[model samples]
Target: MATYEDSKSPEGPSSYPISHTISASDESNTNMPSWDSDDDPKNPYNWPTSRKWALTCLAAFATFLTMMNGTMATVAHFEISEVFNISETSFPHSYWIVTTWALGGACSALFILPLAEDFGTRPVFLSTYLVFLCFLVPQAVAQNYATLVVTRFFAGGCAAILANTAAGVAGNVWSTEWSRSVPVSLYILGYMAGSSMGPVMGAAIFQSLGWRWIGYMQLIWFAALFPVYYFFFHETRGSAILTQQGKSKDKGNDSVGSEKTATTSTSSLRNLTASATRPMILFCTEPVLFVSTLWSAFTIGTLFLFTQSVEQVFMEIYDWSVTQTGFVQCAIVIGECIGWSLNFLSRKLYLTSTSRNTEVPGAPIPEARLYMAVFGGVFGISGGMFTYAWTSYPHIPWIAPAISLTMVGAGSVLVVSGVTDYVVDAYSHYAGSAMGAVATGENIFSAFLPLATFSMYNNLGLNWASTMLAFISLVLSLVPTLMFVWGKEVRARSTFMNEMTEDGSKRSDDMV
Candidate 1:
């Protein structure tokens, strides 16, 4: 709690720092630096209530727009085909309406991370939203598939930026204790909800009006959101914000030659370097972030595969309606919401005084959040796979697969949320790169998953193909548990995590 950065530097040859079970909640004179917002007026943690919610809403909305844009095309594919005058049974070509945006978003993730540092997260965020919405106009007005594809490509890039930036926004707004995972989980809830809701909305709009109405609705929603983000979502880069505030406070009071005093250019360069290098460095260099990101990417891919995979079973076995298909998708929503809600509650519990030391003696260790990741994700992933795999036979009831989808949803949440929280907490300052690793891989996996899903299911049959997916998920689910059991040693061995520890000692605040 002294500070993520220790005022005293280590004197020996790269020895590990001491670890302590600090009382996470008894922040009063607790030798903890910047533990509470009341301790520092300029700190994001200390922002007024109105300001706090403003930022929270912005983060949620940013996540929402990213997600809404990601999935809205699925419902519009029918309209797109008619408008473009194309005919194809291949779901991929039709799915490209959604996949194009997904590909663009996935590709953009590699760059937006480092950019977050130099520009400050707020500017990067608002600009991406505007860009995505702008591309829609051309699509809405396009005369051919080429134009639509191109428009979707660029617009998807904007969506990627928005989607990838969710971590940066959360990191910028919250402390390690107030970290972004729950908000991320909530926004994910919005995302899944939007995916389900967008199609439903698009269907209603298509019935009442036309598919163009889908783009129109999104345009309207983004327009309203863009301005709100500009006015709120205060910068959360600790060094950049503090460095600026410190300069202002130091103006005219201190000599021009003090060690801490410097021109705006110096701060800009540092922020830029911190933003660009650290996240990439973490991805390339840190084991924890890498593994966590991979775990997240794998889980998200399998979860999304299930998004399309369910239809194969339902149609083949039960011969359900399109409405019934959409309704089945709701099971994922139910599961994800429940999983996220439970984790959110756990996070809140860790924040309480009595729950602090009594739980994980380590404040922010990956182990701290493992309660759900292992217990929920591992079992849920396999259980859902097993249930869905064995139950989709023609003889089985339709409800069996729906129940399995719900389990897949819950398992996905458990895995994604837990890994996400650890990365957000562990790589607080370099969240862009850390999250970038995950987001980049995540969308890549999500985008490419369906390409293989059909062939795999076709060749192996539904039962075996699904079982294959379940087997993969089962292996990946063990990642969190492995970390939970050996995370401390993993951190100890990590070059980046150790380097980031200010005192060369581990602290709960730093770990989280």
Candidate 2:
């Protein structure tokens, strides 16, 4: 199949020196058969819009399910505490379930994506979801808390790929920078909405049936999607496709066989090792990755922190039932909806701003992606934190805090989409590695924030603890602002990003 770059690039004048355009007699002597031209029917980018959307929706659903399962036990916190005979002195034990899940996600970010790149996304994607499914039974029928927690850890590890790799899938489908926003926004909505809605569903189920049903629900839902995904999702990895093409050609021709084999094996081994270590190295070396990941980490960590504590606040301060508290968390879903709507406007702004530059391949400014994040960080995140902190008095109407929750939700989505898009634009072919680095930071911080939340509230009180978060948000707000202003310089200094650009350009030329 022709590469995504082929579909996105102009067909005639810009696609210079295409190899497939050789004469019929010249083509017969070629060492390997590739797509006939840039318009190859088998190229995923050339696939019908209906098929593309189907693939995207399935990927998004998988992402939603991961978060749903991760947060399923959240609203069941009280029930689990009671079942395990946990005490206030051992309160952190209750949170260990959440922490362990995050730990698994963090650990998986280091290796799962590398495996995907080495093997192929289809098999790795299928295997992880199946492994995640197997862990659910142990969680649902555990004889003790230890068994439940251990199973949750493995489930989280398996599910981690959902969070990190869905964006890569989105990148696989959408070739142009302008085409990425809506699909990426949809992906973010799935993640944030599932996270918020999970607690709500868990609250109702735990209240009516029991905590065990939460696992059953996840299992049932995953079981339904597994077949849909396995049957419909086509392979989108370019290198994997090329390797298969080479293998197919080897049966008919022997001249290029040894050279192809040696090159393929060596390249595969190097990519595997690089994918395994690049994220870690980038976290330390790349300013853009470091700063963006830190900002993303805080936003996501704070989201998890809120997930753990929001129920406690509503129950105590408003004297609300579990069902009532669950309804309140719907504010997050509302916020994500609003965030997604705002993304449409932001995308329009992006298209209009970059319209002239689209004719020039590989030159879309990464800074453009951060503009929405600026609005989101300052008003959506900082403003919401302050509002929630100040308006949470027992005498205050519950609506006040709910309104604030919307801002937090909106800001979280904006930052996620913005930074993710920026990193992908800046890194191009190495997007998965850069994103894995960011996901690692986000998950690691999220794992620890729950432990800090209870103490923060105890020592600082609800309003003050939240105010502290607001202050931190205010400080981190500069991330998007700085990136917007100076991102070009940051990209200029990135050796990895430069390497990817050079490598991508070479691949684009070779495929043509």
| Candidate 1 lDDT trough over 10 residues, lowest sum | 11-20
TM-score of each: 0.77, 0.86
lDDT of 2 by residue, 137-215 (tens): 8878877889888888888888777554554455565655445446656777887787777777878777888888888
Q: Which stretches of candidate 1 lie over 4 Å from their true place?
A: 1-42, 82-91, 163-169, 176-184, 191-200, 230-290, 345-365, 424-431, 499-512
Tens digits of lDDT, candidate 1, 1-512: 11222212110000000001111111111222232244566555555656755666666666655666655555455557776777645444656665666677666655444444434455677777677778978766777888777788778777756654554444344443344445456666654554444444554555667667667777887788676667665665444464465456568865653644354356545554454455466677776777776777777667556545666678678896443554567787677777767776656543442234422454433355656776566677777888889998888788888888788777777776666556644553343356656776777776777667766877799899888877777776676677655665676676555433442234444425
Q: Native-vs-model 2 lDDT?
A: 0.68
**What lDDT score is found at residue 489 in candidate 2?**
61
Error of 2 at 110 (Å): 1.7
Model 2 bad stretches (over 4 Å): 1-33, 251-263, 354-364, 494-512
In model 2, the Cα lDDT at residue 478 comes to: 72
